[model samples]
Target: MNARKTWTRTLGTATAAGALAWAVVAAGQPSAAPTSEPVAETGPGYAIEDYNYPGADRILAEQGIVLKRGDGHIVLADCLSEENLLRFLARGRADVCFKVTADEGFLTLEIPSVHGVRTDDSVNTHLAMTAEDDRVEYDIPAKTWEGVGESVDGREHVLVEIRVTK
Candidate 1:
């Protein structure tokens, strides 16, 4: 009689545990409902790097400088804000300056009638300019002021780009 009772208890416990496991698995699974609509995107999809210059419109409006794009290393600076700044001299415009922060930097801009550039003490500079469809470039040494665009050829030129290396 004891052996029979033990067998019955064991069978009941086994059945109960199996049922509980089945219940848990069933609770985890979805109901047999068919979906008709496809899932749509929810959050912000992606961020792309456009490399456009920030505050370009405001800068152009305020300072008459057309800043297009850059690698974010060099930036416009106040001429009297600090020492060792890259200075630019242009016809019919105030002197412009830039501050270089990295080992290498590049900026594409349009400062019309740029005729001279004064480099800082840190890096060499290469400038590109255009005059009436003719493009010209100048390589300037550090800690020196050199005649550029219009000063070199007596024709009006627009400073287009600046590339610097330390």
Candidate 2:
């Protein structure tokens, strides 16, 4: 079957359970309609990457990558080699560049070619849309709702659409 429909069906099929499982950080924004214009690529000082990855101190400490994921907390896969681990922890990137983070009241994940920024509360929630495998040839050309996320086990990732906005 087509990937889009498949993904949609998979997500749409789930109701409360999926929302809790995905745990998007929409921060209870209610997935409102987009009011802002497409995020400009060459904005003033820096770029989208900067805004996307502000820091990893809090999240890193929280996950405790050095240790193992026992329960309740998330776990990153051992896909990283010894060399890659050092690079990722220090600089936070690999040729694959998968990231996990949480903000004031949100949790997020970024994958190799995409990004997922959602907010959540202690209740049920899901993303407004899915753009993970949608074949957009641009850098998120405008900000249609999408995301890149990691799995609970952190063994795999969902590199939702990103870096395609104009």
Candidate 3:
């Protein structure tokens, strides 16, 4: 063959081989496009929030108590964790106490069959309890023990919520 024709054929073959190699590499790789349509939430308008307390569900299921929500200010206390913690007395269950972390605190919980709550003078506190027919709120005097639930009305009451302020 002529030198110019031979050079031209060689260059064309190299170009064709390069294109074939590139197509093989591209076909083997995964596509970058999204696979499915975006999901639309259907049920409740409110987005489900993960307001889960770390161990609260297990505690509730095992102990038959519901400690649902808190603002990180008031938390369940180990009665022996600190001195002067607020204490609660229940009719059938052992006493439970709460430790106040901030100057003001709030916690929503359900402890059934509660009878009394004792507070420390450090923070002013309030309690809300519910009976079969009615809900009662109490302004607990600071540093004093207060009667609630069956102690006050002779009816079984469930302590529902608590709030405290310095």
Candidate 4:
């Protein structure tokens, strides 16, 4: 009977020790329950557009011209700002001028009722104009003035755009 009681007590003690060691290990481990929502899968994103010209709207509103996008080579110039510039003569409007800042530049603008353009000698220039049913192009000689629109032909033309290479 003494041996039997000692064996039962030893078995109980061993079982208790095993259970305590398991509890200690479980407490040290991270919880199985999630603490935050799983992140959602996303698709490919899109690219942004950045092709607008700065101050183009104001120029259009104030000058009655639509100055569109360009490569930052040609810009509007105050007629009195400089002695040498590409000048244009418009019907019933003051002359307009553009200053070339780089060795090569291109501009897209609509100047209505343009009759003539004066070119600067420093840069080779080209002008495009539109009439009722025709598109006209003119190669402006360096440092010289050229006639366009009604001045050249009976048809009145609107100056559409200009390109300059220095």
lDDT of each: 0.92, 0.32, 0.85, 0.84
**Runs in model 4 with CA error above 4 Å?**
1-51
TM-score of 1: 0.75
**TM per model?**
0.75, 0.17, 0.69, 0.69
- TM-score winner: 1
Compute the lDDT of residue 102 as modeled in candidate 2: 27
Query: Which is the winner by TM-score between candidate 2 and candidate 3?
Result: 3
Which residue ranges in model 3 land beyond 4 Å of their true spot?
Answer: 1-52
* Residue pairs clashing, model 1: none
- Residue-wise C-alpha lDDT for candidate 4, range 1-166, written one tens digit per residue: 9999999999999999999999999999998886674444354555554535578889888988778867777888898999789999989889999888887888888888888888876998889999998999998877988888879887878888788987
TM-score comparison, 1 vs 4, better candidate: 1
Predicted structure 1: lDDT = 0.92
lDDT, candidate 3, at 127: 91
Q: Once model 4 is optimally superposed onto the true structure by TM-score, how far is the C-alpha of residue 114 displaced, in angstroms?
A: 0.9
Task: Give the distance in Å from residue 106's predicted Cα in candidate 2 to where it truly belongs.
Answer: 20
Give, for candidate 4, the lowest lDDT window spanning 10 residues.
37-46
